[model samples]
Target: MEIDFLLVGQGLAGTALSFRLMEKNLKCILIDTPLANNSSRIAAGLYNPVTGKKMVRTWMADYLFPEIEPFYEKLEEFLGKNFLIKKNIYRPFLSVEEQNEWMGHSSDPLLQPYFEKIHTQALYNEVNNPYGGIMLKNSGYLDINTLLDAYASYLIEKEMLMQEEYQEDFLEVTDLGIRYKEIKAKGIIYCNGLGAMNSKYFSNLPFAPVKGEILDIHQDFCPNVIINRGVFRISLPNGLQRVGSTYSWHDLDTGPTERGKRELLEKLEKLIFIENKKIIHHKSGIRPATKDRRPFLGKHPGLESVYIFNGFGAKGVSLVPYFSKIMVEFLLNGIEIQKEVNISRWNQT
Candidate 1:
């Protein structure tokens, strides 16, 4: 079968790009391996404009934050599913000086858009925020598993997704396009996360894989807004709160460790003062991070039809939507990708 694009992997990166491609009336197919431990499936799916210990604005927050709600809302409407949760993120101040510092930041024009409100006194009685905190707008967590499952069902109904392992040996790269066992496409983009490390096309790129573990705990406290500081605590549908996550670069395996669990618990204690919390579930996945902490986009240097849209890493939830549109533009119109994310930035030597 001949198609415009053959996308390998049905994770967030592939899913977003495929949807964007289809929106432009392009014929595409997604080949995904049925892995139970996929990173997208286990990600916390939080998108915060302000992050880190210093509580600074994330990279490209101006460009990325605006596209997030509209993109997910449109997709939710198309799939007829409700997976986007629009909740403010409340981050407590570590000291009075920090609170005073944020009070000054509230007036900055550049940071004004994301600023919701700043609390001077304790907001909740169940938590440990004695100094007060800052509430941020346009911040929330996406129910990724729900969205992926619904999107997968839609793809299956549309006959656009193929559930199997993609074999590179059968792939043929020609001057015109690419050819797999029975499929012929004008181009094939690899969105297969760390699986790209095994491909000859992208193996040279530095992929720093990091393992993260999250826990679903049955806690009595259910805050309306997401509490993010040392660790993020997101309230789920049931009487459970999803808390995580610990990052470990040395251990890249997708397995939850006792050390990881201990780390999360210690951080969780600092974030909140909750009692009678029980660990209901523990899960882990390895993110396809890069050395410079930017995504790999654009076509391969030597092969015209070969491209990669991987390496968004832990920020995939926030990065994919905006970059997908950019990728589609580059793929259809031969528009140039931003140098920061372009794969061409890395020297093959």
Candidate 2:
């Protein structure tokens, strides 16, 4: 089979990129063995404007937020499902210093519009905070599972997606093009998430796949907003709240550990106002993070036709739309990748 593009993995990165390419009349095949343990599938897909311990706005939150909002909304229409949900972010101040730091950063004229002057007196959750925290006007969740399944189903219905995994041995490289199994393509794009660590074209990109666990509680006590206590709490669309996610780089195991459960429970119990909330599900997956924690995008320097669009880490909801478009433009045209995200920065031809 011949196609214009061959994509490995069906996570958000691959799905978004493939969707963009197919928009330009390109035919692509997505190869993957759906891992229930895959990070994108298990992620809470939370998008928060105010992030980090300092409680400052996320990097480029102003630009990225606006760009991502309409992108997910459009995907909802294309996929015939809702992918993005908007909500407020309630951030608890852990200390006086932290509160002061928020005061200092809040003065920035650039950040002023996003700053909340009135301290919220509302205690939606116990949150371990006696003093009320500030509320970010814009924050919310993306339905990663729904979007992934919908895209996978879309491809399957068209017979363009395969459930089988790819083995390198079957690949035959020639000056003509790259070949894997019976498929020949003008080029191959590696969007395999953490699996990209072993990719021949991009293995040296310094990926740090961090493992995180999220607990899904079936309780309705979860407010309509995402609550962040520096380390936890998120709101889901279906009235399910995700209190998580515990980050661990050393223990890269995908299995949901007893430690993760215990830790999450301990932290979550602090915010549960309702007495009888029940545990619904526990999911663990490793995010394909980079050393700088920025997304990795663009084509390989050595191989003109080869490319990558991975290393989204925990910000897939915020990062994918912006970079995915840049990547598609780079794939279709000779668009110069931003230096920060270009693949060539880590290596040379």
Candidate 3:
């Protein structure tokens, strides 16, 4: 079959790309192999406005959030699914320094737009609250795994996906175009998450893969909203909650580790009481973190028809809706790609 585009890997990047392509009435086939060790499959699908220890709002929040809101809603409508929801987050202040930290920044105009002034509260006085926190608005979570499964099913039903290993050798590229198996395609895009760590075509870019561990705890009582502290908790509709997510840049193993569990528990102990809880699941997955920590997008310098859309890192939840839409426009129309995220930065280096 002849097609307009051929995509490799069906994780968030590929899935998002295919969705947009189909929206443009493009004929595209996705070749997916059961993901190797680490991809976006295990992502918590979290989007935090203030990140890191300093609590700075992410870049381009003014532009990104509004674009992402309706995109996921549309996905929910199309798939008959409901993974994305708005639940307020409770950010507990760790110490007096932390409270002073928030107060010191109340005058900053850039941060003011993202949230309101800190209000005093004692939700966990018995637990730990040297100070309190300001509630963040316009933030939420995405059920990444749910979206992936639903999209996979949609592709299978439409015969738009293949379950097999995608070897680059199968892609016969020439001055004219590209070919794979029996089909000819105008362009081929690789949205494989960490798999690009070793892709011969785009591996020249500074790609950093980080391994992270997530813990599922079944407890007697838990808050419906996501709670932020030393360790954050996102509530699942399934009644279980996801926590921890310690990032390890050195070891990229997928096996559950006792160290991550103990570390997360040590942090959790400072606040909530963990008396009678069942440790249901513990697994590790790697994210395609980039060197500068920005997403890597756009086309390859050498290969004209091959493209990439990866390096979402931990912010896949928010980045997906914004960047994916932009990518679709760049492909369907003659729109100029964002320079900061373009893979061409590494060009001529």
Candidate 4:
């Protein structure tokens, strides 16, 4: 069957892009394997507006953070499921210097939107924050697994999803467009995350893959707010909390390792005053990070009919929603993509 676009990989990136494409009256079919190691399924799905050691506003927070909640909420309404949870993130100060630094940042007009309040003392007894913390508004987590499953089901009901692996051997590029097996499309977008590194079309792009792991633990006291410092601890509905993640550039495997668990445990212990926390679950996934730390978007340099919309890294939950809208607009209207994220920047070298 002929379609407007063929999307590879049904991870969060592909799901968002496909949904946006269809919303614009573009016909597209997504091919996915539903692998157990799929990054989106294993992601902690946290979207923080303020991040990093210095606790600065995340890149493009002003533009990106606004689009996140509404997009997910709209999808949740359309899919008949609730996965978006808007919550405040409490980041404890590591030292007096850090607290003083934030004291000045809290007053910045640009940061007023995300800053809720800054505490001079600890907020909760369970959290070991001696130097107090900063409460960030407009931050939360997305239940990615639930959202992906619900959206996949929606696509299946609409006959827009195919559960299969993408075979490049069967693909043929024509002057009109590209054809893969029985499917013909005017264009194809690669959203296969780390798998894109193996694609002959996009492999040359500086795709730096990083391995991340998270743990699900049952503790005596679970705080309502997400406690972040050394490790981010997100509370679930049950008497459980999700804490993670350790970044490893060398070990790229998907399996949960002793070292990863130990590292996370060490960080978790440092963040919260918890003893003997029962480990319920452990998971790992490779982030499709880029060398420049910006998402890779737009058409391939050599193949005009081929394109990409992946490499969201650990911030996929935050980046996907905003970039998908930009990508779809570029796809449909020939609108100029933002130069910072446009693939042409890399191709120019």
Candidate 5:
């Protein structure tokens, strides 16, 4: 079988790129392995424009935020599924000083787009917000599982998805393109998350993998918006509230740990006053982070038709949609990728 591109991995990175390629009427095939610990599958799926302890706007928030809803809405229409949850994010201030600082930020034109409202007084009676918090607009979580599953079905129906492990050894790089057994493609792009670390071409790139754990707990407190402070608490369907996530670099092999659970509960206690919360599930996955915390995007230095589109790390939900368009443009139009994200920053292409 011959195709234009062979995408490795069907996680958010692969899914977004493949979908964009198909939208442009480009022929491609995706090879994926559904691992129990796939990062995208187990991710919190939260996309907050304002993040961190300083509550500063995230990197490239201006570019990434606008593309998110429009991109996902189109996917939803195509798949006939509802997975985008456009809810506000409520982040409580740690102190009165912080609250006052945000009051000034509310007027900053650069920050005004994401600012919903700055509450000086407590917004909810059930929560602990003595200094109140900031309500951010254009912030929410995607139902990643629903999106991935629906897209997988769409790919399968179109004969563009192969649900199996991709053996790198079988791949052959030629002057024309690439060959994997009977499959021939004009180019091959690696969107396989940390799986790229094992590839011969990408192993040299610095990939700082970090493992994160999240919990699903049954609680009566259901807020319309996501509560994010020390730890984020997102209200899901039914009586369950999704709370997470702790980052660890050493404990990559282990799944969810008792230490991670304790850390989450301890953080949760500081954010809200709750009683008798039942833990329904605990899951974890290794993020394909980089030393510089930017995504890796570009063609291989030596191989003409080989490329990579991975390493969005914890911010994949926000980064993928925008960068996927950029990647597709580079692939089809020979447009030069931005130096910041291009892998050639490390190696000359």
Candidate 6:
């Protein structure tokens, strides 16, 4: 069947892109291999205005943050599901000097939009924030798995999704477009996460895959808001807290390791005062990060109809919504992509 686009990988990138494409009245089909360890499914789905140890504003915070709530809320209404959770993020100061430093940052005009109240005392006695902390506004986590599952079911019911492994050998590129088995489309976009590494059309780009592990523990004393310090502790429903994310560039397998668990526990120990808790679940997934820490976007250099929309790394929850709109616009109207994220940036390397 002829369609406007054939999108591979129903992960966050593919999911968001498909929705954006169909919203524009473009006919699209999504193919996904359910066996693939989808990083989007396992992600904690936190979108913070401030990131990193230094706690600087995230890249494109102004543009990216504004689009998040509306985009997700609109999608929620369309799918008839509630998955967006808007909550505060409490980042405790590591020292008095850091607290003083943030007090000065509070007045900065650039940070005014996301800046909330800065506390001189601990917001919660249950948590280990003796040095006070900064409460950021417009920050929260998305229930990515819930959204993906709901969206997948919607796609299935609409007959727009195909659950099958996409093999390159079966693809035939014609003058009109591309054909993968019975599917014919005017163009194809690959949002298959790290699976892009196997594509002959765009494999030369740098893809630094990192393994990340998360744990769901039943900690009673965990704070209501997300606590960020050495590690991030996100309060979940049902008296469980999700603590995570150890970045390991060497061991790129999608398996939980004892070392990973130990690392998370040790880092978590410094942040919260939890002594004992039952480990509810352990999950691990590989993120498709890049060398320069930017997403891979735009069309393949050799093939006009082939495009890429992967490499969102740990920031997929925030990045995908904004970039997916750009991708759809670029595909449908030939609009130029952002220069930095464009795949052409890697042409010289």
Per lDDT, the best of the predicted structures is 5
lDDT of 2 by residue, 1-349 (tens): 8999898889988888898899889999999887632888888888877777666678878778777878888888998998787877777676666666666666687776664553534465455555667777656788788888888889999999989877766766666678988899988888888787877767788898789998878775656667777345665656776788889989987589999889987776665556566688988888899998888888777676677889999988888887888888888888898888887777745
In order of appearance, the predictions have TM-scores of 0.98, 0.91, 0.93, 0.97, 0.98, 0.97
User: 1 or 4, which is superior by TM-score?
Assistant: 1
Better of 2 and 6 by lDDT: 6
Local distance difference test, candidate 4? 0.88
Per-prediction count of colliding residue pairs?
0, 0, 0, 0, 0, 0
Winner on lDDT between 3 and 5 is 5
Clash pairs, model 4 backbone? none
Comparing 1 with 6 on TM-score, the higher-scoring candidate is 1
Give the TM-score comparing model 4 with the true structure, all chains together. 0.97
For model 6, name the residue pairs that clash. none
- CA lDDT, every model vs. true structure: 0.91, 0.79, 0.79, 0.88, 0.92, 0.89
- Cα misplacement distance, residue 127 of candidate 1 (Å): 2.0
**C-alpha RMSD of candidate 3:** 2.1
Superposition error at 95 for model 5 (Å): 1.3
The worst-scoring run of ten residues by lDDT in candidate 5 lies at 32-41
- Ranking of all candidate structures by their lDDT, best first: 5, 1, 6, 4, 3, 2
Q: Report per-prediction Cα RMSD to one decimal.
A: 1.0, 2.4, 2.1, 1.3, 1.1, 1.3
For 1-349, candidate 4 gives per-residue lDDT tens digits of 9999999999999989998988888899998886532788888999999999888889999889989999998898889999998889999988889889889887799999997999989888878888899999999899998988888888889888888878888889777899998899999999988888888888888988889999999888776688888789998977789999988889987699999999999888877776878999998988889999899999977677999998999999999999999999899888989988998888633
Q: What is the Cα-based lDDT of residue 235 in candidate 3?
A: 66
Q: Give me the displacement of residue 53 in model 6, in angstroms.
A: 0.7
Give lDDT tens digits, candidate 3, residues 237-299.
889978867888987776768888888777777666655667789878888889888998887
Q: Mind giving the per-residue lDDT tens digits that candidate 6 earns over 138-198?
A: 9999998888889889989989889988898888887788998898898899999998999
